[model samples]
Target: MKQARPLPQYLVQRFQGWRATTFGENRSWYRRLAEGGQHPRAMVIACCDSRVHVTSIFGADTGEFFIHRNIANLVPPYMPDGQQHGTSAAVEYAVNALKVAHLVVVGHTNCGGVAGCHAMCSGHAPELEEKTSFVGRWMDILRPGYERVKDLPAENQIGELERQAVLISLENLMTFPFVRANVEAGNLSLHGVVHDIAEGTLKEFDPVSEGFSLVG
Candidate 1:
């Protein structure tokens, strides 16, 4: 297979122009963000996909959200021992260090990572273990969520899978001592959200309805 070429120089040059636009137009805000520590109202766990930026999706300004992005936006259960756990560490810092008031686990429809769950649960791709692909390991986090909702209709499985995975992550978020303490004390709230990339609409999980509904 031919190697993919790098982004063209014109696009790279345009990147600087975009940054300059933000920097030049928002100089005072950038300076404040640099000098004063971030005090975001919410912490968002989002996907690493280039198209699914949480800030832009939420129409947020600088320093509005403490954000962490990983494959499929999955968060693992807490572990006490030190590990190179990028996702967990981000949660710890956002909740404990930054003390954000809200934590949102944002899943999206038609996600490549969630779709990969069907293959993972079926164990049809053994080659994944050898390649050590990032998607393979990250998909493992969804196994529990998959098992919980596997009996649902094939068409509905992906939606339930994504939603339940966010719920699992929200539950896992509480495993961290700080998050648990803060949430139990009513100082912090947890939310599960799903974004439809094609439509540019957001749906948040409603405990009363026991399903996802439009956020607005």
Candidate 2:
């Protein structure tokens, strides 16, 4: 039998330090959380980018927010097919089961997945078009978003496309019956946000203005 590789020494040391410090100081809180189960009020869908820190940005505690991260923070339109759908399933659980009050889709600048989608759609990355390319297949969900911003100059398209990811996800989230029902019933709200990674700034979508506004 093949043995599983052990975790890296650095990670082990970090975990030990956390266990001794942060975990130790909050032991009772952790215990209470374990016993009570999670009751997060908000559900955040964010990019897999390491720079996008959802909990830190909101100053959220351990059990305050239910977070789900995926490539480009894209939420595909609801498809009730028998096949597996990780993002949709999470949304269903968050809205139907957890009853989160708010659903936020957070996109970020300089997203590699968005850039790859831009490349693939523009015919610059022919390799991604192959059926065997998982990234390409997954990114195809963002094709419509790309089309919406294709007219922009090459230099500006990426940033616009990044914001489009959040917008698209927000739009797609409504396609889920559970999400729409909760939202229309005033039990849930949907939000779209874009983070400028390098500048450490955020822009929130304004449904009234139909555009994103800087958060002061």
Candidate 3:
């Protein structure tokens, strides 16, 4: 309880500035959103990378997306073992409660989580291999992705692995019974996209083509 602390001064000032400008100008919109509750059109599973601005990338406003951020933007295979599953819970709510039509998994370049998975798989990061490491356990969800790209040149693994993370998550999303039902009924769609940080471009996976294509 003692660990709680006040927000930094810069953030406080930034919030005040936003309240004065954005909030002041859009007060009615904010009020309507609060009253109506969130009915986002999509659910975005994305990396917790600070540089990945999911909202700005899609030109979406508040209440437009139900976003869940985690390391590597991974979705673990569905396990209804009565354990605490934050990502799964969010997926359930977005799929069942919110009834979102589109579910997008967003991955990005130079992801620290993907790199850690590579290091751990290659026995280079013993720290991440330990059972006590929360990050290690979480990154374990992407091991299948690492295994798929392990044989490629070391230089090529990172980028490919990043995309694999997105694909793997999309695959895992179907493991959820509710998600599977919705997809089967044509009520929901799954998508995977990788944002190239250096190039500022997006690549979307096409299941029919079995590859990713440039997105505008």
Candidate 4:
């Protein structure tokens, strides 16, 4: 018979290995960061995908971005009512407490959530209703995105779907009063980014250029 290994043992092994490598080289940097508290220049709202790591994708350091992760990286519309809004709470802390200079909504290609939305909107994947629950409400933020790219050609689906979602999220970010106030004051900037994990590339939405471009 095979023996069962405890989950805690595997976790300890991973932690110890990480400490030996990452902590060994930059002990002082991490130590200072822990002491100084989180003072990131930006706050990145990204998906909680194992493959889509925010810091790794941005080539950022430990304290560079105050990251908040959720399914599909959805940003709920700001509401005064007492709802269980974890994503909104994180955004509030990032904008109100951390006062980050930039707020970036990072979407990606081949996103299961976005793909599911495409299915739900198109009436092709009715199983979404029976199998998934939260995605219905969470993906409401991307309704405008669906409307924007609903009629695009099949070849352009990959590019347009992800692009439209990022644009919509960027617009939604402004709907938050704190985001709007800070942006109007010229103290805060908003950005939309899409990570193409398959191609190992990133596309950034350039406001000045008014289009998505490859990021070096």
lDDT by residue (44-141, candidate 2, tens digit) is 99999999998888889889999999999999999999989999989999988899999999999899999999999999999999999988999999
Residue runs of model 1 more than 4 Å from their true location after superposition: 1-8, 129-131
How accurate locally, in lDDT, is each candidate?
0.84, 0.93, 0.96, 0.83
Clashes (backbone N, CA, C under 3 Å), per candidate, total: 0, 0, 0, 0
> Any idea what lDDT model 3 has?
0.96
The most accurate candidate by TM-score is 3
Runs of candidate 3 with Cα error greater than 4 angstroms are none
Clashing pairs in 1: none
Q: Where does candidate 1 have its weakest 10-residue lDDT segment?
A: 122-131
What does the lDDT read for residue 200 in candidate 1? 91
RMSD of 4: 3.5
Tens digit of per-residue lDDT, candidate 4, span 65-101: 9999877777766786987888888888999999999
Better of 2 and 3 by lDDT: 3
Error of 4 at 157 (Å): 3.0
Model 3 agreement with the true structure over 59-104: per-residue lDDT tens digits? 9999999999999999999999999999999999999999999999
Q: Which pairs in model 2 have colliding backbones? A: none
Q: List the residue pairs that clash in candidate 4.
A: none
The number of residue pairs in model 1 that clash at the backbone is 0
Candidate 4 or 1, higher lDDT: 1
Model 4 stretches astray by more than 4 angstroms: 1-8, 130-132
